[model samples]
Target: MSNRLLTYNPETEGAEGGLLIMGAPTRAAQPQPSTELEELELGSAFLEATSTSELASVVNRILRHGALLAGKPIASQVVQHLGARLNRAGQSVRTLLAPPAGRSDTAPSEAMERITGAELEGLSDEDKEFETARAFVRFAMEAGRLAARAPSTQPPAAVATAAARVAARRHAPGLDFVQLVPGFRARRAIRRQSFA
Candidate 1:
């Protein structure tokens, strides 16, 4: 009997003589254009996903079907495409299936003690890890097609804080800094009014 689960020998006449059926093979119903995890053909049919969910669904389906192409070139292309989709979805491929850094093997815990030592901090380690993991999954699901629009909000507090710093720098110094808006623009408008 042939070791392959799915045999395709044309000469193998009967089920017994030719392609002897062994075990249930994880084969798709005729290898159509892989909707998601395909041969990584950019201009191929995979690029036609109309929505984010559609793209994600396709990739997930491909993964489920064990759609692995032979050769490094094909594999690399597939990885790149997957990465791109995940990035578009605001996720990273590396962390897609990885549990949080300190998570246990079996049962996932809500214990934030190990992730972060600072109890007073509003942002917990668990929260950060969960957010990161979510982003990775979303990215993978969407087939690495990053969105063109601005992100809904900064996924990480650090990014938001950095943006705040940038805004602060762009504007003039505030009144003793606390609870005061910058006066630079206001001062300019006042000068213009005087000239008018």
Candidate 2:
């Protein structure tokens, strides 16, 4: 067996273990930080993911960290990551982003300005993807923005647009599983609303 640390998952014993990405690689174990600064830096590793594709893993990692930190630091990371994308998003995506409320992040608010000020009658599929992803980011941001959870209470990057034949279940109450990561899933998923 792999030397990677195994987090026990009781699949087929219940209906919830299915949320894990099937066949996800086991994460290599790393040393616990020796310093407070190191620990703080290591804490945000989830946000360092490079693409929108890794959204689910990044989001889930964020959630895991929330358990550790007792807050939604991951949500803020999602907003900043997605916000950067939105800032650089094509004119179409920018046009679709609805303005955020006064307390919202800048990118959402920036997108919102364009959305309300523009006619925005018709946009291409890519634009809609941007819009949808933006909305998901906004929804997930509630973890940090308000310190609360939404039904879709989650975060991550590269929210998929394709449909995949996924078997999903509710997140178990105390533990989490990481099956096929959002990046891999986004490339292969076969459904409308895929998440990790």
Candidate 3:
């Protein structure tokens, strides 16, 4: 009978006695879907929306999807806060589309004129709708960014204001249109009756 010798090769064996095979190819990780593509698709959907309700639906879907992706359900209060801000923006767009009461021939209100200058009256219906949709998308993006953080870290109004500021910048850079769109505190008091 012949005796066989067993060898423990340090290079092929782990310190804990587990075999460590070298040169073995590991499985590749699956690729994640691109957020930029998703945002582009959402933006297109927003632009294609024919009505305010349709646009709201798209916004809701986006916010919910964002919450899900973040692994945290959005609070109802947060949703309401966002809805209120969106309503303000929608009202602003409606106002822009139709001239103020008893002032059909004239431009929009003095406040609107002050905020947007003469450009307010020059925008066609299509242009107004496009700008409104763009503002909504920008607001939604900013809201999603804020919502990703711990809910208790900031108040809903603060979050809404921050998002609205970003949206306003996207809507009309270097303009004070945020007061007309989201109606921040300074202007909100002045337009409280109109909003109601």
My TM-score estimates for the predictions, one after another, are 0.19, 0.22, 0.46
Q: lDDT per model, in order?
A: 0.31, 0.32, 0.51
Candidate 3 residue lDDT tens string, 125-159: 56544454444555565454445433344555554
> Higher-lDDT candidate among 2 and 3?
3
Any idea what lDDT model 3 has?
0.51
Error of 3 at 100 (Å): 12
lDDT of 2 at 154: 35
Scanning candidate 3 in windows of ten residues, the lowest lDDT window is: 22-31
Q: What's the CA error at residue 28 for candidate 1, in Å?
A: 23
Instruction: Between candidates 1 and 3, name the one with more favorable TM-score.
Output: 3
lDDT of 2 by residue, 46-74 (tens): 23434555434544443343323323233
The prediction achieving the highest TM-score against the true structure is: 3
Q: After superposing candidate 2, which stretches have Cα over 4 Å from the reference?
A: 1-53, 61-121, 148-196
| lDDT against true structure, model 1 | 0.31
Clashing pairs in 3: none
TM-score of 3: 0.46
